[model samples]
Target: MSTTDVLVVGAGPAGLACAATVLEHSDLSVVVLDAGHGPGGQYWRQPAPASGPGALDGAELADLHHDRGTFVELVRRVEQGRAEGRLEIRSEQHVWSVVPDGERYAAHTVDRSGGPGREAGSTTRARAVLVATGAYDRALPFPGWDLPGVMTVGGLQALLKAGGVRAGQRVAIGGTGPFLLPVAAGLARRGSTIVGVYEANRPGGWLREGRAVVRNPAKLGEGAGYAATMLRHRVPVRTGRMIVSAHGTDRVEAVTVARLDRAGHPVPGSEQRVAVDAVGVGWGFTPQLDLAVTLGVDLTTDLAGTPVVGVDDLQRTSRPRVYAAGEVCGVGGAALAVAEGRLAAAGIVADLSAHGMPGASVARDRREVARLRAFADAILRAHPVPAGWADRLEDDTILCRCEEVRCATVRSAIDELGATDARQVKQLTRTGMGWCQGRVCGYAAALLSSGRPGPAVERLISAPVPLGALAAQPTSEPHVE
Candidate 1:
């Protein structure tokens, strides 16, 4: 078992920030683990060895922006700390399970590449654990979404950022939120023909958050910069629009885009087909609450329509010795994540001041957290997922691609089999048993099951069933009733 004063999961902005913050203490040893090859979790991308430092194509910049200052700083600090024998950074380590061990916690990881069949990796035990696993992309199913060239925006971005590859010869980037802009601009800059950008929200929504934007002048500048880049590339920005359907025989060839009515319903006569080789789509984002929820952290619904770990002023959750920061707590931008990471580190420091390294002044940390949280709330409200999105899903469309479950199966489970919840529907049809475990399809499944239109982020982010929760079940039990 490997032990440390703080075990920060994920090497992304939040994890790196937390690790950097904890590294400031000489007495407190810190260990940062990430499933990726290096630092810069989801946001940062390193150029290929053959390519120069700045040789990254346009899509690469889209990811590096999120790596920001604190993220880069964490990488530098970890390297320096390793030389000084104070910190350890473990890369390519995927944590599969985490369990509480008395007063401490044990993180069970797996060596995805290094191990034999189902081999167990080393364990990391720490008095305090900070989860910054970040989030996975949410894929809402539509007709032809399962085509070969159809991919989530994050998947394309990750391909470009991590592997230095492009999505396709021509790509249509459609989604909501600020993420789409950077992706479209990046691909366009890389000489990929970005045919269109279909966003579900109107420009007025950004103006509605004008007050919040003013609070963060740098964020405003970032938005302006992205807009300027997009305008320069002549990428069509279709606000109040959505890709109703993706059309292709074996690969994505075109998409049917439609204008949304004032209530966000699709207008009948506004459908238009746009030719594109690949389609990158997403709704927005949801917090990754698996690790936290597994630790028994309480959850709260965020304005962005995702379930997030409930954290107090200092980013401390209900569980002792556990703290959540960044997108896991809520889908705040990079700046807010940096602030929260430092604030959590301070809280941890204060708790261990006499026993270890001294923490920063409490007053300063509190003020910083409050200001960032307020800004986060404004951004969240501005980017709430559109209502009635499920109405856009076709009856025959594949909802859960991993399980090969269609909207018809989900509807039958709820309407015919009386599935009152997502779990029951999953049990009946194996809807959520895919590789993602329903991270991408949980919202659509819940909406299909409930027959109502509201945010399903809270339900999606709940803890996965513990072995104990399933241990009492009979081996030959019947399907959900």
Candidate 2:
């Protein structure tokens, strides 16, 4: 087993920033393990490597990302730290569990970098552990949502960013929040015909949070740029509208768009049929808390009522020597994540080093986090999940695609089986006892039964592992710092 002064569980903006800060502020050794093949996480995901070396260049993928400069700088610092032997990064390593070992923590990981003679499972013990696992796309169910061409907006973005592939020639983007804008704009730029951009919430709600809007001028500029792109591509940006249902035989060939009432229900007379080969939908994000829950960290709800890891201003979790940053704290953007990460690193430095982080730097990062988080709250308020979303579910609509649990089964569990929460529903109807372990269907299930998002389900294994890997785990105790 390997040991380190600090172990970061992600290489996203938050993890990268935290590693860089720790290296610059202290002499401690750091190791970063990420499931991604490289750094940048989902926000700045790079394209897959070309068949030959130097075939794909940064210039080719530049337009696919936002805030490239920040990603570049963080990567540079991480590379420098690795070169000087102050840091190590294990890419394509999925850390499944973290357990308390005396005064330290032991992280169990499975190597996912498929190749010849790869170690299946291993453990690394660290003095301090920081989880920046980030969030994933939260999708709600509707008729034909399980169709072949239906996908989350994040998935569509991933396809374009990671593989330079457009989801379809004709794409209809539907969702709430500012995310749809960028996805629509990117696909439009990539030579896809955007049928329309359907947003369930009206942007006028931002007027209520005028102070936050003024505080983040950069966000406004970003929005303005996307607006320009939409106008340039002639992509229709319709507010107070949502895609109620997708329609097709074997794949999605059209969608039903409906204007939403004040209560977020669809207006019966306002439905319109739009033709599209691909449909992308989203309802904000759910913070990834699998490892955090396993570590027994405190949990709380964010502004959107999504469960997130609870942390102090310095990003310290309830568990001693444990910290969490980025979307795990809340579903803010990358800038806020970076601030929180740097702050978490500062907390670690203060706790572990003889010389703690400078007061001025800590204070500055705190202020930045506060400002960015406020803007994030504003965004959440502006784009809440439509209250009547579940009301539109048909009896045959698939709720859990993995197990083919339909809306009727879920409703039966709730109304007839005395299931008041997702857990009870799962026990009664097998709603979440599938391969995904409720990651995709948990949010919708909770909302349907309990009227709120469910708590993160605790699991010893965060991701699926090969049985051979489990058998190959070493019996020796991991060395502690």
Candidate 3:
């Protein structure tokens, strides 16, 4: 087992920024552990050598907008540190659990081969841990959502960023948030015939948050650029509408789009069927907080209806010696993530400075954090989840696809089976025991099973253990003597 002064648990912007900053000032060693083969998280993903641009799907194309240069430089810095024997970058490693022991912590991880591949796997210990595991695109299932061609907006972006692929020749990008516009336009630019853009909120909804956007001119300009691209492609942006259902025999061949009322409920006679090969849909992001929550960090509900690790101005959590940044704190975009990461590193440095090491330039880093946080707040307030979103779901429809648990089963688990918490519901109905280990289905399960209470909700929920632990362990075979 190896040990380091600080261990950053993700290769995303937040993790990398923290690692780079720590390496800049102190003799304290830093190590980065990530499951991705490359430095980029889902956003700045790069293709494997065997993977080609043609292999990219619609989702992959959308990830191209990520600032690859920043990630590249991070990898370069890590490599330099490695050459100097000051950094250890463990790629394709999936961390299972992080348990605190005294002033240090132990992190368990398996090799990328998921235990079956021919690789050495081991665990490591660190003095302090930085959780930068980014958020996941929430999967809200509708009728026919289980069809093969349906995917989340983030999934499409991952395919493109990692493999230079697109989802299909004809595709529809439908969802809420500023993420979809760029995703749709990116896919369209890559030769995909985007059928329509369906958004649950109307244009006027954004007007309510105009002051927020005005405060962040760069964000405004970014949105304007995405809008301009969609306009150029004539993609027919439909606001206040949502995909009620996707219809197809083998794969998604058509979708039923409907205009919603002010309450975001479907309006009668407003439904229209549009033929399409694929539909990329998502409501928004939810923090990937299994590690943070598992470590007993205090979790709070954000405006996006997700649980994020609560942190102070220094990014320190309720747990001493633990810090969080990036989407783990909330679903702020990469710029905000980078800003938080830098501030977190500075904070760590300051805490370590009592030993005579000069910490990160405090005044400068605070200014950077303040600027980015203002922008993040603006973005969050502008994109609050529409009310009564669960109203769009049908009872028989699947809510947790990982375990084939339907909404009806979830309702039964709560209403009939006396299941008061997400764990009990999952135990009774297998709602969150899927491949993703409840990352995809946990939020929906909690909300459907209960009213999704705040700190109380956390008590009711039992997040799945990281699946990386269950990989087949290689053992010494018996000698046939």
Best by lDDT: 2
Candidate 3 lands at a TM-score of 0.88
Give the clashing pairs for model 2.
Answer: none
lDDT of 1 by residue, 342-400 (tens): 77777677565555334344456566656666777875555455664666677788988
Stretches of candidate 2 exceeding 4 Å from the true structure: 53-59, 115-119, 477-481
| Per-residue accuracy of model 3 over 117-171 as CA lDDT, tens digit each | 4444466778888989898897667888999989999888776566657888888
Give all candidates' CA lDDT scores. 0.73, 0.91, 0.75
Which portions of model 1 miss their true places by more than 4 Å? 46-69, 113-120, 355-365, 451-481
In model 3, state the lDDT of residue 370: 65
Question: Whole-model lDDT, candidate 2?
Answer: 0.91
Q: Pick the candidate with the highest TM-score.
A: 2
How many steric overlaps are in each model, in order? Answer: 1, 0, 16
RMSD of each candidate relative to the true structure: 5.7, 1.9, 5.2
Candidate number with the higher TM-score (2 or 3): 2
Better of 1 and 2 by TM-score: 2
Per-model TM-score on C-alpha atoms: 0.87, 0.97, 0.88
> What are the clashing pairs of model 1?
307-457
Using lDDT, rank the candidates from best to worst.
2, 3, 1
lDDT per residue (tens digit) for residues 315-338 in model 2: 999999999999999999999999
True lDDT of residue 343, candidate 3: 74
